[model samples]
Target: MNILITGGSGFLGARLARTLLAQGSLALAGAPAQPIQRVVLVDRVAPPADLAADARVQPLLGDLGEQLAAGALPLADVQAVFHLAAAVSGECEADFDLGMRSNLDATRQLLEGCRRAGHAPVFVFSSSVAVFGDSPEQRLPEVIEDTTLPTPQNSYGIQKFIGEQLVADYTRKGFVQGRNVRLMTVSVRPGRPNGAASSFLSGMLREPLAGERARCPVAPETAVALSSPGNTVRGIIRASTASSTEWGARTAVNLPALTTTVGEMAQALERVAGKEATALIDWEPDAQIAKIITSWPSRFQPKRAQALGLAADESFEAILRDYVRENPQAVKLAVKG
Candidate 1:
């Protein structure tokens, strides 16, 4: 089986590639496991040296939008596709054209490519929790369910929701076997911050562990939904492999989330790495970022995802410890034993 992963150079994208490589095969729920022949990674930048060095990896570097419109992706032979690339929330808000081009236009072109391929490849679109927001028509419920209608309040969310609908329609037409998985904010990401409003969620924890100062754009008490990198990757894979009957409807599946406040995340950091690490996080609020981050619904039932055997992290502390363990070189502060 040949697979394709967009955003292949990113943290989660790279991690997912490593996971698939380690497993050595793609196993659909009802179908026999197929040994991975090659994994074509599509991204603007090349993937990590370790991932790129793998014999099975084929890195296709360039803008996804341009690549797709030119029919550049090796789609004809691809058996599975994980589309994870997008302009994040802050970037989308800052530049509407960037979001539309990268998120909406690129998605449409990719789907069109799949239709032309005529193979009906399993296409997994990575949606976002930002898709759920309060609108004048209806205030958000205390807990968002699988059946809740998405009322996107931001351009990023709007783009993701649109992508989800497109995937649904494409599947309905038998052009592709589409699966839409809505991911929560993945916390404790190892790397410098990106344009995502939720980047601070990972930054605060990551920078502090590195013995560097970090800014908290939202209030410590601000509630947010989070998932570990491991859990998020697993949920994405589950979405692609589940049988049609097991998957139920073609609607977007909300990946499980661990709901917690920024205050609690700080507490968890202290528990894992001691007060010195937590002290590095400065309470510097950016109102625009806070507004966007808070607009997303933090609580979720995710009945559909749970039924698919996906799960959230046990706790934020465990997530912190996992990050430190996985990226030892990134951690300079003394982690509690």
Candidate 2:
């Protein structure tokens, strides 16, 4: 089997590629476990050295359009497609044109490409919690369930919701075997801040660990649903590998997540990294970021995802511990007797 991962150089994409390579085989619906012959990774930037050097990994270093046109996407042999590319929330809200191009148009093209391939490939789309939001009439419930309708409030949310619809319709038309997942705000991502309104969720811990100053855009009391990257990647893989009959009737699932407040996350950080590290965080707020983050529902009843075997983290402390383990050098050890 051959796999194609758009935005293959991203943190998740790269991690997924590494995982697939390590596993060596995939068991598809109603088919025997097939060896992965090739994994084509498409992104504007290059992947890490080890991943790029692997014989199975074929990196197409360019934009999606350019790579697709340049025969980088293995149309005929690609049995699975993980569409992880998109303009994130902050970027999408800031630039409408870029968001449409990256999120909507690119996804349609990928689906069409799969259709044209003459094989109904397993299409896994990475959607977001942004798909649900507050409108003028009523407020979104404290705990969002799968049955609740998506009422997007931002351009990014609208774009993601539309993408979900397209995937559903494409599946309905038998163009592709599609499954989309609404990801929560992935906390404790390792690196500098990006434009995402929820980036601070990670930064509140990530920056402080590295002895760098961090900013908290939202208040300490602000609570939001969060999932660790390990759990998220697990969910992604499961969504793509489930049997056709077991997959839900709908084309999307709201992934399970733990509800945690910013204060709790900070407290966890302090527990692990100490009071000095916690002091690195500044309590300055950004109205734009706060508004966007506040609009998102902090709790969920992702029944479908739970049934499908995807799980959320136990707590923010566990999440922080996982981060510390992954980056031991980033955190200072507690003094011993």
State which candidate has the highest TM-score: 1
The 0-to-1 C-alpha lDDT of every candidate, in the order given, reads 0.92, 0.85
Q: What does candidate 1 score on TM?
A: 0.98
Tens digit of per-residue lDDT, candidate 1, span 203-222: 99999889999999898889
- Summed over model 1, clashes come to 0
What would the per-residue lDDT of candidate 2 be over residues 102-200, giving only the tens digit for each residue? Answer: 888888888888888887898899999998887568789778998888888888888899999999888888888888888898888886678777888
Tell me the spans in candidate 1 whose CA falls farther than 4 Å from its real position.
135-137
Give per-residue lDDT, candidate 1, residue 259.
96
User: Candidate 1, residue 87: CA error in Å?
Assistant: 0.6
* TM-scores, one per candidate: 0.98, 0.96
- Where does candidate 1 have its weakest 10-residue lDDT segment? 25-34
